[model samples]
Target: MGNAGRNAVVLVVTKVADATADLVIEQLNARRIPIVRLDPGDFPTSVAVNAYLGNHGLSGSLRTPSRIADLRGIRSVYWRRPSPYSVADDMRPQDAHWCADQARYGLGGLLGALPDAHYVNHPWRNRDAEHKPAQLAVAARCGLDVPPTLVTNDAERARWFARECGPVVYKPVRNTDYHGDDSRALTVWVEEVAPSEIDTEVGRTAHLFQQRVDKVADIRLTAVGDQLFAVRIDGAPGLDWRRDYDALSYTLIETPPEVAKAVRAYLDAFGLVFGAFDFGLDRHGRWWMYECNPNGQWAWFPDPITERITAALADRLQSPGNAHAR
Candidate 1:
């Protein structure tokens, strides 16, 4: 590494409880790299940003509790899951909402404007890539095998689509906070939907329905820059492997050249440098694209795979290069 990389700071934007971030930070620390970790949610409280625009460009400093980082000298930004911006609870509800919005745009904008730092997956890009509709369309365009999918809020249309694509599964367009009557968290797992189960309640919001893949296994392929680590997940109890993670076993697997090519193309299309892709392996050994989580978790995997992923991330973060290809 040259002086620029050797001396540059890696800004980690994430929550304090992230174990994945901690792993990468350990690697950087061992290499004696400079790192500044902060959560935007702490803005106006524990975190602060001071930026200036001049002839050169935007320059500033971010001060967190443990460290201060020079924006101009930042080499890379690991945009992990950061907490939402918040304000003092004593403020009126309206005032608090407005304050939070300002904090989001103000401090959030500054982080996005860092002059030289490369973001693993820029927040804006992550937001855009999070849409399942766009992801399916792009996956098909990139030569990946995407299941027949439909996104609609019309009850009749949803019923018709289910009839046509019988044995379909209902999936949430996006996973958001949902609670039951008891105020307990709830999850809408992917489940086989019979056409008769469709009703007017579906009209309340949009839903995603896809022909369920007859798969023998699932794959969680985590890509960091050009490096892809694929693992075959076996023994999932149902349609969604996530429902029973404890029952799953993993085996390191090689990605088919065609699938690998399409994955890179898909990432390029989204301008994403990192993505955790989910795929279903059919009985015939074909991979069906499910979705890609731009900022997905990886530390939950077994140690060997997790260590490899951590090293790949550290390699990308330590080097200076534009992750945003578009």
Candidate 2:
């Protein structure tokens, strides 16, 4: 809901009452940015294909724009993590598909409709933005060393790659919709996959296989505009660092000039102004591109991370010259 006269920023997040996004919301408020949160689950089952916000202010919300005496005034938008919902919990697959699809594409369009409001990362662009294979290609084009990779559904081919490479890793082709208790599911870390385990029957579904690189460290590159910052995560054991966040140690590190240049190109390739990229630094310290998450979480990271992102976003959103055109 827009306050008729107040400059309100709307944030669409699930479980708005809890979660880390709430902390970001608090920070926004501390900066005196008026915010209104909407849970997608609470929205109408269907919506128009076009965006609906007006310069006059937001309407049809928990608060009334006219009564609140507010004008349409959201200066920027941060597409943080979106909340989750299940149509299977109640509706049929087809019905659920339509509902979720419309909400995602539609709600995103509405936010994009905001006059002159800057988006941290646009959704339409994010759709095809981060495929692992595509990222690898981009990394190579930018002169970054990309590890040998194989994506297949054939058991024989997968096994052959494993046997040829000895120690290899297997993971999903894209991000899965499972989290919370399933944090383990987010791992794309390297592990030895024996060739014997390959079911000549793997033709059932497509799986990703990659040659494992012995890593001496990991790096998380957070890019905001032209500003590139990387943190070297040292001494993290196990294939997935996310599995043991508590034990991981971090040190601010400078990326190679070429690597930094490549990171910017990778984000620009996706039309993204922000991203959190994961890389496996080989035993020789050569960086191997894993994936770039357009909406990856970083609030839990170090203070410099928070300061860089928050300041960059604020500058873009509050710029007097970036106003939306009617």
Candidate 3:
């Protein structure tokens, strides 16, 4: 291994400003691995990413000119966040945006393009990975069940379709932002639609609608390469399975061979090494695919799930002098 890849080993790029991310940093650091936590603002204007790591982890000198020096010896990276390029008050909106965008795009591109270091989930690959239509198409190709969905802007057209489907679902097309402190971001809402309910706002942004399946239970699938883990969750009236974690039940379910294969294929198709996926288990015990987050959160899951994920990541990074592979 080269000096960058050897003495100063694994680097984890995370939103270091958040408490949740801080807690995660403690855990990863406790694992006895050298970790570097970087906030997006830490980068210089018109900078290259030179993340210098010494004995003290991230506090080491970061020299950014030429930028290539900072990207050295990175065996692997975990794209954990709070996004670094958050809009702030000190700088003018336009000025801040120009710098933040440059740093965000440039840094991600530099590290992602590293000839040897492996990124846990490449940022470029994560792009277009969350489009519901794309996810649906990939799932279908894997032979998984998906509810009929429509992406429409015409209120009349959406109303007509919702009326036909009755209890359809409304989900954010991509990721949603939460402003409140200690926020919860899952906003999956189910409502029985009537034609009168449609509004002009639906046209402003494309409406993504799906038929609400009569879910017997829900499944959370976490995938790391070919390794797969699944947990069953029960959803009742009023609360979605995500928010009702307290009342819900969880069981380690052995994923069917085909289900595992499909999930693996879906990840590979998107060029992702880790994903958190959702599945609706119907009364017939059939699985309906929902979505897969290319850089999803999984720390809240049970120990076995956590163990499998952390081990898979560590294995890939330290794989017997293995060069960074897909």
Off by over 4 Å in 2: 1-19, 45-72, 84-106, 177-190, 304-308, 320-326
TM-score list, all predictions = 0.96, 0.78, 0.81
lDDT of 2 at 10: 42
Residues 14-97 of candidate 2 have per-residue lDDT tens digits of: 344544456566666677866655454544532222233556544332332212212245545656655553344588888988
Best by TM-score: 1
lDDT of 2 at 40: 48
Q: Better model by TM-score, 2 or 3?
A: 3
Runs in model 3 deviating more than 4 A are 1-5, 17-31, 45-70, 86-90, 178-192, 320-324
- Give me the candidate number with maximum lDDT: 1
User: Which one wins by lDDT: 1 or 2?
Assistant: 1
Task: Sort the candidates on TM-score, descending order.
Answer: 1, 3, 2
Give lDDT tens digits, candidate 1, residues 286-305.
Answer: 99999999999889899999
Q: Which ten residues in a row have the lowest lDDT in candidate 2?
A: 62-71
Residue range 149-182, candidate 3, lDDT tens digits: 8888888888887888857777767657645566
Candidate 1 lDDT: 0.90
Evaluate model 2: give its lDDT.
Answer: 0.66
lDDT, candidate 3, at 275: 81
